[model samples]
Target chain A: MKTKPLILISNDDGITSKGIRTLVELMSELGEVVVVAPDKPQSGMGHAITVNESLRLYKTDVFEDLGVEAYECSGTPADCVKLAKHHVLKDRKPDLVVSGINHGSNISVNVLYSGTMSAAIEAAIEGLPAIGFSLCDYAHNADFSHIRGYVKRIASEALRNGIPKYVALNVNFPAIMQGEIKGIKICRQARARWQENFDERKDPHGRLYYWLVGDFINEDPGQDTDVWALDNGYISIVPCRFDMTCYESFPAISQWEL
Target chain B: MKTKPLILISNDDGITSKGIRTLVELMSELGEVVVVAPDKPQSGMGHAITVNESLRLYKTDVFEDLGVEAYECSGTPADCVKLAKHHVLKDRKPDLVVSGINHGSNISVNVLYSGTMSAAIEAAIEGLPAIGFSLCDYAHNADFSHIRGYVKRIASEALRNGIPKYVALNVNFPAIMQGEIKGIKICRQARARWQENFDERKDPHGRLYYWLVGDFINEDPGQDTDVWALDNGYISIVPCRFDMTCYESFPAISQWEL
Candidate 1:
């Protein structure tokens, strides 16, 4: 008999969050699931790793009813993926690595600031086939019901077809309240940016503090962009790579006299 | 005469690190300098932003001797850039944004985990020209004397010719002790990763803890890669973009049945 695929799971949301719990339940149906995730919420942690501090990983019964083995780590999302790959599952290669049914969107430029996507990206860096799933909702109790089947299908497709090497799928579904998710579209990241507006406030200590808030601005009008797909009520699957090199700029920079 | 180009400087290292000091000294020679860096070291911070907490920014006299206006912020490197552009600088547009003379190398895949490069990447996302510089040495007081002229020339060239839109240059210098500095090579990010090894130990209280330590593994043998340039004693300058999309993988994913 063929052994079931071993699937490793993680998320930027703390291990006990509804998001990771949903992810755990979904991945459990597909493989032998093992989870290593942050002990606290790690939203907006990007590709960060724990360098200056020691980390603690404690096994938890968070997914006891689901029969999923889990460990909660005191580190960033990237740290969880590293510890999972290096220590928790030493010499045991996972067939697929999944991160997040994130509480918020990680479309366009937000991917660079996403702890959820960073976990998947970190897994890809380790040569693992990975996927990061997110819904276009920011509520702590965001409903992930409508997209459960899609998530399973996507993960299954990834397992059967295998994601392209060195890439991670950033899959985002429209919020359930946003009518119906039309379908999935393979797209590229749109040209977008966050227009920052710092909310200045005076604390009780008489010192000024600021809250980092921003309005996302999507400048790309291309129909092939992830932002466009999301706006049209479609799930977007953008294959994100770790190589940040802009090869097109080579000719321009090569002419520089150094 | 035209006012000297305003150069906003920042780094992953704290405002008081020897690396930022060297960067400030070099940038001051080329333009009007404004420094806004982290209050404490933020080495592996990647592109993290402080979302759940308020941030404090205080005017500091660290660069007062150089007559450079500076501020120290209790946040990550990316926060400093956002704060600098949105709150500190306000409507005054900077001509250039430069981060680091980082005390260590940020070559190859290290760029993804680098707080130094995150500052520059954040600037690029804001539609500004930026560059991140690093030295191969990891010492706190590494020698910067040898690469002084090269640093000046690179910044001068950037000031004269704007960086490609939505891109930041990742410039890394070979450590001074690594033989004569050869020249500069505009290269691509090499295919490399850190082979993470968790150093597990027990606390005095008998609780087990782990520290992340790794050996950088360069898997790419391409001569045009950043790793090759640095290994051969050349300064590597890779044009990095904010977009992480793998467009080539679109066709493969498009074939997925959803």
Candidate 2:
């Protein structure tokens, strides 16, 4: 008999968030779930690792009754994946790594600063098939129920057909669409950015400080972009890679008089 | 009179580091330099932004003698660029943004998790020409003298010839070679990753914690790789982009039965 596939889970949100809980509940049915996630929220941590500080990993009973082994880690989402691969699972490599049912959208340029996507990317870096899921909603009680079927479908497809070399999927769901999601669209990341405005305020010390505030601006209005797909009520799945090289620009740069 | 170029400088190491100081000193000769860097070292910070916490920015006299305007920002390298562009520079935009003469190398896969590279990527996202420079040495007192001439040449070339659209440069210098350094090599990022080994230890209270440690392993042995160039005593320059989309993997993923 084939043993159940071991699925590793992590998220930018803490282990206690409804997002991870929903992810755990869903992934448990698919395989033997082993979760190693940040002990606290790690939103916007990107690919950060805890190099200057030491890390602590504690076994948690969060999903004990669900027969899912879980651990809470004192690090970013990327660190959780690293510890899971190096320490938690011992020598048993995971068949898949799934990160988040994130509280907010990680579409377009947001992926660069997304702890959710970073976890999946880290898994991809290790040659593992991985997926990161996010919802358009930011509320703590955001509805993930609507995404369950689609998540399972994507994960199942990934398991059956291995993810392409050096690639991972970044899947973002539209906030509980009134109608069903209009299927999935594999698209490119939109060229977009947050037009940042720092909110200046005075502290108790009478010195000034600023809080980062921004509006998401999708500069690329092309229909083939993840931003457009998400806006059009489709779950957007972008193939992400760790190789940052711009192959197209190489020739031009090589021609420079160095 | 020729209008001097406006150069923006930042680094993963704080404003006070010898790396940024060396960069400011060198850049002042080329143009009017403005330094906005992290208040403390932020290695492994990747593309993280300060959202949960407030930020502080203060004018510093660290570069006063050099006649370079400088500020210490309590944020990541990316934040420094954003803040410098929006708040500090006000109506004036920088001609170029250069991040780091970093203490350590950001070659191959290191660019993905490098705060130095993230700064340059942030600039590139705004359609600005940018470059991130790093030396192979990691010591705080690492000698940067040997690479000064090369650094000036690269920066001058970049200013004389604009960087290709949607790309930034990731430049890594091998630690001060015994012989004169070889010529610069325009290369692709080698497929490489750190093989992590967590040093497990017990706390005084008998609880356990782990220190993140790793050895970088370059899997690709290609001659045109940045890793190969740097290993062979040449300065490596890789054109990098913010788009994480793996275009080559798109067709294969589009066929996934979702």
Candidate 3:
């Protein structure tokens, strides 16, 4: 009998989150699984590596009932992928790497600062097929039943037909009921950013402090953008890469006499 | 008299580092300067924001010798730019945002996890011309005299002829003597990554811990890459964008039946 495909999983919300638990349950149906995720919540970590600090990976029996091996890492999501590939699964490359089922949306400009997407991007950087899943809900117990089917479908498809080189999928779901998901749409990341305003407060020590708060503004009106798809109740998938070179602006800047 | 152009300065190496000090002194000669940098070293911070905690911005006399207004922010490099524009310099946007004179290089794929470059990228996302500078040396007091002429030249050029829209410059200077410094070259990011090997150790409680360490491997052999430029004794400048979309792979992924 052919052996089941091996799948590596991780997330920014730590290994015990309901989102990753849901993801593990769904992915277990597809393949043998190994999880190496942060021991504490690492939200907003982006692609950060723990260069100046030490990391710890401890074996755990959390997924023992599911017959899966798991480890808790004291590092960012990106570090988990690196350590899992190099140490945990040495010489055996996983068929796919899936991150998150993130608590909040990682659409458009948010992708740049997302620890969930960073794990997937790190896997792609290592020449592996990967995808990051996020729901447009930030509640602690957001419903993820609606995305289980889509997750299985996308992961199975990724294993069957390998993803393009140097690219990873940034998949997001609308916060809807099991039957409310309209279908999935592959789209481009929208042009968007946060318009920030800090709320200042005086500390007990008579020092001033501010909380970083912002209103997300989506400037792109195109129907093909991920923002549009998410707002319209469709699952959005945007292919992202690490190469940030602006090819369009290259020639223009290259023309400057310096 | 014509009003002097306003330039904002920041770095990942905290407000007290020699690198930011050099940057301030050099930028002071070109324009009116305001600095809002991290209060502590934030290397490898990536594009992180301070959403979970409160931030603090306090006045500092560090740049008083240069006759520039300066504030030390209790946040990441990216947050410094956001607070600088939104609160500190309200109603008046900076003409240019320059980050670093970094103690170490931020060339090749390192730009993704670089706090210095992220600050510049934040400014670019806000529709401002920005640049991030780095030297190949990693010492506390690396010789920066050789790059002073180049830094002044690039800033002057960026001010005279603005950088392209949605693009920021990731500039790196090689560690060399004054006369050995070659001319600047516009280049692309080299394909490279860190080959991580966590060094396992025992804690005081006899628990195992690991320190993250890695060797960088540049796989791209192109002559026009930033890695090659720095290796060949030239200043490397890569025009980076905040958009992470892989436009080439979009069409192929869009064809998938979902």
Candidate 4:
């Protein structure tokens, strides 16, 4: 009997989401699992941390399973990763940090606004190899069966061989039946955007309200992008990082008079 | 006389904060200024946009004395930039977007968690040149007599010559006497972070609370970093981009099996 790898799992959909439930089940086969995630849904909180407020973490039982430990955190996904590393796992760093089976896609421009991906990126900042997973559907019952085996295989492989420093994978799976699934394809995030549409409604108290609604528009028709991969029924895997400097432009600005 | 550049100004601090007010006042000398800032402070929001909630925007008379049009937005700093472009300044796109004279510095890793810098990044994403400014002191009325001219010069120069696409500048000013100013230096963001310390407190009702308090730990002491420039009494300017990809590692990972 060999000691298992300590795997830390987190999500943007709070502790009780079906997405994380599925993720936890798959991750359990790969290693010893510890879950630390937000208590409330944190959909679009990009790279946010709990700096001005106190964070409350509760010993939680999100899954009624055997041999797994979990805690629900009252903060952003990024905060969960930070606390998990420093406060929760003091003896040794986790083998890997995994975030999401996010309810929505974090492809293209959405990557900048994703709480799920930010958790993964934050883990990578602390020298932990990380992965953020998303299904291309926002519905609560979005099909994730197609991705279960692939997810398990991916995590198992990454643990066996370490990832590059300061980098994480943004993995998105197409929402389709398991039988119809195509093999996974390593891909780049497509250049895409949300065509903003805000719907206004009147409250019972005569106050105005609005809900964010958008149709994603992908202008990048390149066959190599993550968007294209998912569209063609393959899982998209884009390597993302925290350092956002466009170093190629460094020399061009150095010539400027300040 | 031809119309001056239409500059959109905002900050994570609420409309009434001294930081945004100072920014608007200084920008008034350089261009046609219009402010759309939060009605309440939104520190540490970190690229957060108000997508999940209704927005309330109302015109304010605060900047009428300076002959600048202003509005108060019930949203995050990123929302102010979006609303300014789509709803407020629909006729003409802003010549520039400027955020902050923040109560504290937004250098290095702080930029990753800054709503002030996020406002600038949002503007850069929208194809407008932008800048975020911060002072080292966290007081509401920190003496800011120094660096006023530098703000005017930098904003004017950015307007005079357009910035590179998808890029913005993060500028930090030293907290010092008016005559203690040095020149500006274009530099890279230093590798830095907050040593996480969550201050726990008890409410009057015996409820537990926490305030996010910590010391900033700068690990990089490179001579060409923004931290170095500010430490040397010079204004620090770091060109930042929204693309979070480490392109140099792409090819290496592309060779790996998916």
Candidate 5:
């Protein structure tokens, strides 16, 4: 009999978080699961890797009930994937890599700052088919029950048909409060940006400190965007690529007098 | 008379590093320069923002000799840009935002892991014209003497002819050891990835730790790539965009049975 496919899992949220626990449970039924995730929360870490410091990987029974082998890593989500690929898994290549079931949305420009997506992007860089799942909610105990079936279906489709080369699927679901998700729509990242407002405060020592807070502004009105889909109660699947080159702008830059 | 163009300078390298110092010196000649960089080295920080903690920014006299105003912040490169725009500069919009004369190259996929490019990308997201410059050499005291003219010319052209909207220039220079620098070329990021090898070792306390090490493997042979231009002694300028959507892969994903 053919062995079940091996699925590697990780997230920006610490290994013990509800999100990864949900991911671990969901992935167990699909394949043999191995998890390597951060020991602490690393949200907004982007595509960071720990290069200046040494990393610790401690084997954990975080998913003991699921009979899954897991390791808690003292690094970013990207570091977890690197260590998993180069050290933990060794010669055993995973059939699929899944990240998040994230506590927050990674729609539009947030993908640039999402630690959850970074894990999936890092895996994609290693030529693995990867998907990062997120719900449009930020509560630590956000309800993920509504999207479990969709997540499983998406992952199953990915394993069967395979994702496009050099791309990672950024799958985001409408919040549970949105009632039933209309459906899934293949979309492009909407043009958006966060308008930062630094909340300045004085510490006990009278030293000034600031908190980075912002409001997200969607600049694109296209119906084909992920933001539009999510707003309309539909799950959005934007195939993200690491190649950031703007080919259309090449001619404008090429005309420069260098 | 037109006011001098306000130029905000930052880098992944700390404020005191020779790379940022070189950048500050070059930018000073072009316009009014303001420096807000990390207090310590932040190489490979990618686009991380310090969300979980409060950030401290202190006015520093490190660039006083150049008569340029500067501040050092306890944050990543992207954080410095946000702080610069939202808090430090407040209402005085910069005409140009320049990051780095980075001590190492951010070519190909390295751009994703580059803190240097993150600052520029952050600026682009804010609707500001920006450029991130890097050298092929990784030494702390790498020579900046060879590329001064090229750097100046590039910045001049950028100020004269605004960069395409929502695009930031990723400019890289061949190391000084490559002899006299050739002309510049507008190119795309090459397809390349780091093959990571974790150097595992037992600590003095008998706990195992690992360090990330990697070899850059260029998988693209296209002559119009940034890697090719730098390899052939040409400075490469790749216009990078924040949108990570792989639009071409939409058809394949659209057919998924979701």
Candidate 6:
């Protein structure tokens, strides 16, 4: 039998999230899995890295029973990938990077705020084939049943074919019954936003406080968007890159004098 | 007499850093200044907000004698802006948002890892004109004299002309003496990156640790590039926008099928 592929796993919802458990369980059948993830949830920490302070990464046999190798990292999701590549897998580079199976959807503009997508993007920047997985629901007990087969198939295929170096995939599943999942759709990120409203409050000390709240608003109801894909009972796969140069508008913007 | 524009200021480096002090001092001449910034350094905290947890924002007497409204936030640069808009300034919307007289340059790929630029981006997303300023020097007491005039002129121009909605400016200065300050250059983002290298060490207990260390690699040296302008002793200005979609690639990518 051929040696197993080396698969590096990470997530924004920390090492103990149910999502990564399902992901690791699925990927275990495909490869030699190495898990390195944030010690706690880092949900919307877009591309953040712990630069100002010393980071603490500890090795433990946390998943020995799972028959997989795992380590916990005390940093953001992006830092986990970097640390994994540099030290955890020092001898050889991983064949692929897979982040999340996150509790909340990273469709549309949410990708701009996703620690999950940022991890995958960080991996892609290092020329690793990477994929980020998310579910539409934010519930702790969110279902991953509808996405397992698709996740395994897509991840294995990606490992087989090898994704283009600069591109990473952002995959989101609808929070529906397994049988209700229609199929998969490759689509663009929808033009959407979070209509923000902060909930104000007073602390026990009588000081004012506020909680950030927002409703996800889909400005683009077009069928070509990831939001539409999930809404229509299909999984969405969006190939993303991080060189955020709006090259098309360069000429128009270049006209401005300093 | 014309009212001085109300300019909100911040930085990733804690309020005590020379960066924000220089920014506050410079902007004071251009407008009525209000500062809401981190009490601690937040370098590499890209687009992070203080959610999923309680935040503590304290009004400080730092620079109190200057009569500028200054407060230190216990959150990321993005959070500072949100709190500023919602609670700090209940009377009026700020005329502009300015973040960073950063200790180091935030050109090219660095922008993706920047708290300062993200603060500017947050303001732009909130429909406020914004700018992020940086000095090429990373010294804690980096000299900012050479770029004071340029900072004032560009900021004043932005206040006068206003920016394209959803777009902000990222300005970087060369580490040169005040007299050697050649001129200002408006340019596009240069294609550059940090060639990542993680230095692995072993603790006394025989456990492994890794330090993320890297050198910046500039691939674009064109005159119209931000890096080139900064290198040529001219303050570099790159107009930035928050939408990360590569709309040009959408047509082709839309053709991909499962």
Which model is ahead, 4 or 5, in terms of lDDT? 5
Instruction: Give the DockQ (C-alpha) for candidate 6.
Output: 0.41
iRMS values for every prediction: 0.7, 1.0, 1.1, 2.3, 0.7, 2.7
Query: Which residues of candidate 5, in runs, are more than 4 Å off?
Result: A177-179, B177-179
Q: Please provide, for model 6 over A65-130, each residue's C-alpha lDDT reduced to its tens digit, 9 standing for 90 to 100.
A: 789889898889988988888777977888999999899988887787799998898897777889
Residue-wise lDDT of candidate 3 within B35-75, one digit each (tens)? 99999999999988877889999999998988999999989
Model 1 ranges with Cα > 4 A deviation = A177-179
lDDT of 1 by residue, A1-258 (tens): 989999999999899889889989998999999999999999999999999999999999999999999999999999999999999999999999999989999999899999999999999999999999999889998888888888999999999899998899999988855357788899999999989999999999989999999999999989999999999989999999999999999988887777
Chain A TM-score relative to the true structure, per candidate = 0.98, 0.97, 0.98, 0.94, 0.98, 0.97
Q: What are the per-residue Cα lDDT tens digits for candidate 1 across B15-104? A: 999989988999999989999999999999999999999999999999999999999999999999999999999998899999998989
Cα lDDT tens digits, model 5, B152-251, are 8999999999999899999999995536677888999999888889998999999999999999999999999999999998999999999999989988
B118 Cα displacement, candidate 2 (Å): 0.7
Report, for every candidate in turn, its global Cα lDDT versus the true structure. 0.93, 0.91, 0.91, 0.82, 0.93, 0.83
Ranking the candidates on DockQ from highest down gives: 5, 1, 2, 3, 4, 6
Best by DockQ: 5
Off by over 4 Å in 6: A1-4, A220-223, A248-257, B1-4, B200-208, B219-224, B246-257
- Candidate 2 chain B superposition, TM-score: 0.98
Q: Which stretches in model 3 have alpha-carbon errors above 4 Å?
A: none
Please tell me which model should have the higher DockQ, number 1 or number 3: 1
DockQ for all models: 0.89, 0.85, 0.79, 0.51, 0.90, 0.41
TM-score of candidate 3 on Cα atoms, chains taken together: 0.98
